[model samples]
Target: MSTKINELSVVDADKFTVSRTITIAAPIEKVWAAVTEAQHIARWFPEHATLSPLAVGTTGVFGWSDHGDFPVRIEELDPPHMIAYRWGNSNAAASTLESGETTVFRFTLETVDAGTQLTVVESGFDALRDPAASMDGNRGGWDFELDELVAYLEGSE
Candidate 1:
């Protein structure tokens, strides 16, 4: 199977949401695990990750060597179909979910002949001091991280 790159798009300039979609050559269950499970997430995205039970209101942290851990809360969860997290804003110091300076990351999955179509939409960039820059940074980030995820899953298979 061939690898695929994520398609990036801006939801709206004023809203400052970055959306990305990638098709992976793996089953929906495998893709869901990679996106939700800490062990699988650490292998592809964050340098380190700790996720609580996969349910609404559960919290977690995703850490990078350069940037410290960022608090994350499960805002929405729907089995192997969808999961959404409200995470700390990259521009501010790591903070709690109650803090207004947080962003939303929603991931939706659909089974396809290729395997799964994963669409990730991260919003709330407008809440940050520098919306444009943050949106641009995360656009590149999702591109790299999702591509890494595809590589990890395909390689292991």
Candidate 2:
């Protein structure tokens, strides 16, 4: 399967949400694993990720070498179909999920004729320190990050 990296995420200025929908040339199961599993996420997402066993309340840390750690929690889960994470947006070295303005990013997946169609909706940016800046930063972030996900799943990375 082949994949194209694109800036497909949409920033909603009024709703304080950023949404992106992309079709992956891989099975839902594979894409689900890449998104939900920490090892796979660390490959494409943060430099290091620590998540506990799958559960709605499980908390973890998504860490980056330059950006530090972001505390994350599983806000919702529905097997291979959906999972939502609430994470702090702080750039501090180590912070709790409650230490800063947090956002919920929900990933919803569907089986398509070609493969899987995944949509991520990140909301609650209105509560950030700088709502516009945070929204803009994450808009670009989701574009690059999800593109990596597509490439990783399609074996083009």
Candidate 3:
């Protein structure tokens, strides 16, 4: 794994966003699958996931045993490069695909000499109920989850 792990934080608290860029010591394709494929994502991200035949408008659910299930929809896709999903807030456990205001979290991958550079930008927290609390929850979320991704890929876990 790359010794250089970048720590990212909210770009603008008023705007309600979280952004981070990290380099993983792995091929772009490997990183791509981890972020785009449900099965791979479940290993590092949510405890369980369900999605296949990936594409824009694809619907799926990401669940954490303690956090509850969150329904998500792929809002954008650019194969092996970038993908974005609109998901319900953690504060809204009952929120569904159509029921609540959602945030869009995007993952972008690029190949570098060392490995793959992944950047994540999650926005629209301002739209959710208890936006401050939601933003605060996710501020720590990307840190924990992305570290898991790094550990899973780097075989550190």
Candidate 4:
């Protein structure tokens, strides 16, 4: 099967932030839930996930068999429009944002004639122990995971 690849751009070399954007063939609400809700998120992004209420300060955890669990907390939420989270370090055993080894993950959705435009921007790589390697890893991670999201959502319809 042919795969859809999202566009990735390095926003700042010094800050180590990268942005990825992909258009999916689904409504904004559906896309929002797929990104925010634990069940839908697990289908695409993580092996397993648990999210609290859709509000700021709500905490969650994303688990991968290899990486174990990474703690996450909602820093911002706007229903079907935007959601942002502070997630623990990918390269370390950080369970809290207070550990000072975390990154910001922001997902923004926009309605369009075709479907929804989803943009994911993950920053704070400079705080990691190995910024370059971490940026490369997450960049590839988003490319693979977002394609799974499109396939899951579009194929389900």
lDDT of 3 by residue, 1-81 (tens): 579856765656877888888889999999999998998999999999998779899899999999888888999999899
Estimate the TM-score for candidate 1. Answer: 0.92
RMSD in order of candidates: 1.8, 2.0, 1.4, 2.4
**Over the stretch 65-153, how does candidate 2's per-residue lDDT look in tens digits?**
98888889999999899999999885322356775578899999999887988999999888777778888889889999998898899
Q: What is the C-alpha lDDT of each candidate?
A: 0.85, 0.88, 0.86, 0.85
Stretches of candidate 2 off by over 4 Å are: 3-7, 91-95
- Give the TM-scores of the predictions, in the order they appear: 0.92, 0.93, 0.94, 0.90
Which 10-residue window in model 1 sums to the lowest lDDT? 2-11
Using TM-score as the yardstick, the better of models 1 and 4 is 1
Which candidate has the highest lDDT of all?
2
Ranking, TM-score, top scorer first: 3, 2, 1, 4
lDDT tens digits, residues 1-157, model 1?
Answer: 5455457655567667999888899999999999899999999989999997888998899999987788999999998999999998778544667768788999999999889999999998877777888888888888888888888988852
**Model 2 alpha-carbon miss at residue 5, Å:** 6.8
**Clash count, candidate 4:** 0
In model 2, which range of ten residues has the least summed lDDT? 91-100
